[model samples]
Target: MAFTLGSLVLLCGISGLLTGVWSATIVPVKGNNCPKGWTQLDCYCYIYEDERRTFADAENVCNILGGNLVSIHSDLENALVLELSEAGGVAPGGGIWIGLTDAVSEDDFMWTDGSNVDFTNFSGGEAGDDDGDCVAMVTDTGEWVDDICAIPLPYVCIRETFRH
Candidate 1:
């Protein structure tokens, strides 16, 4: 009985040591607090809520948080934007501005990141020309439209972590 008791204690100590080592080495450490009104997606954080600001101001805010204005390039991204707009409880009359415009010229809509607009998800034909250079999202219609980027419109910002 004495020998058994000693062995049990030894085994317990070993198990505790192993658990500590595993926890210390296997678990990844999370650093810093996430940006305000943002949620983590994978290793990056995102804010899907609509914010009222000019295009330049929106870009500045996103850059301060190490990100850029939301740029939709795929159907999945477009669907996500729709979901966020609905969830934000924005009034039916309000529209969300996206990070797309042909302000550089006409009929040459591009993202603020300087990427070519490969996907044109506009509802009313191609954007630009005839008072349509900026892009805004209409939740009621689920389409993008060209508008004036200088206008103070609600916009979406995207923040991605820099992996080094």
Candidate 2:
């Protein structure tokens, strides 16, 4: 009976020590690791607010926050944008500017990350480049369309991680 009690005490002490270490190292620092009005998704942080700004201006804002305008490249990314849209209470009015454009040329859409465009979630027959070489996310239609990148519009920003 004494041996069992000693074993239980030893286990409890080890668990308490581990819990202390975890709380000190693993617990996130409020507003430091993640900024105010932002949420952590994977290794990135995202702000779902709707802000009216040009694509370049949006990029600047994101840069100031150690991030960039949102760029969608896969089904998972698409779903994440849809989720953010819903969370931000954005309605179907105007399209939100994303970090995609073919401003260099037609059919040459590229991401700001210097990566080639691999995924496209544009609406049917949209992104026809009738006007500009930029892409925007339509809230109502939930699709991408080529537009003037310089035009000011609501946009979502993506914050990258900086591990120290």
Candidate 3:
């Protein structure tokens, strides 16, 4: 196992390449490439569907459209979603299903998009057991509340902006 100069150089080069690869940060590209009828915010595109459907059904629809139910991670994002739903003609007092749920473990909510639950807009005493596992945003105030998954409601969907 004698080390040769060429072999040592090659090993060092490979190690350096791996280090560069591992340390690279993926910065999302912000562009105006969202699909038609979808609104772009940051790196994501969002859309609201006024059709009333149960949580599962709404999620299915979103999946069919190449996304998942919207996941709000900040107040600005939450307000944008609320605005999108309202502009799309959500009935007053009606709710719109979001992607948060604790179905796997009650009270431990997670977003279906696999994004971190870094923010929430729940109303007072929400994420409680008074309702079921699903979460819905009350159109009146854009506040979230737990609700039964079987309840039909409008929904918002989101996906990363695509480059065309």
List model 3 lDDT by residue over 1-164, tens digit each: 34685587667668778776433333558556788999999889999998899999999999999999999999899999999989999977889999999999888899998889889888884565666899999998999999999999999999888966
What is the TM-score ranking, best to worst? 3, 2, 1
Clash count per candidate: 0, 0, 0
Q: Candidates 1 and 3: which is better by TM-score?
A: 3
For model 1 the TM-score comes to 0.68
Candidate 1: C-alpha lDDT = 0.71
RMSD of 1: 7.9
- Cα lDDT tens digits, model 2, 1-164, are 99997787677668779776422223436444567777666677778657788888887887787777787777777777767776777776567777887778788778865656778888885467468777888877678888887888877778765465
Error of 3 at 133 (Å): 0.5
Clashing pairs in 3: none
Off by over 4 Å in 3: 1-31
Look at candidate 2 and tell me the lDDT of residue 69: 78
Best by lDDT: 3
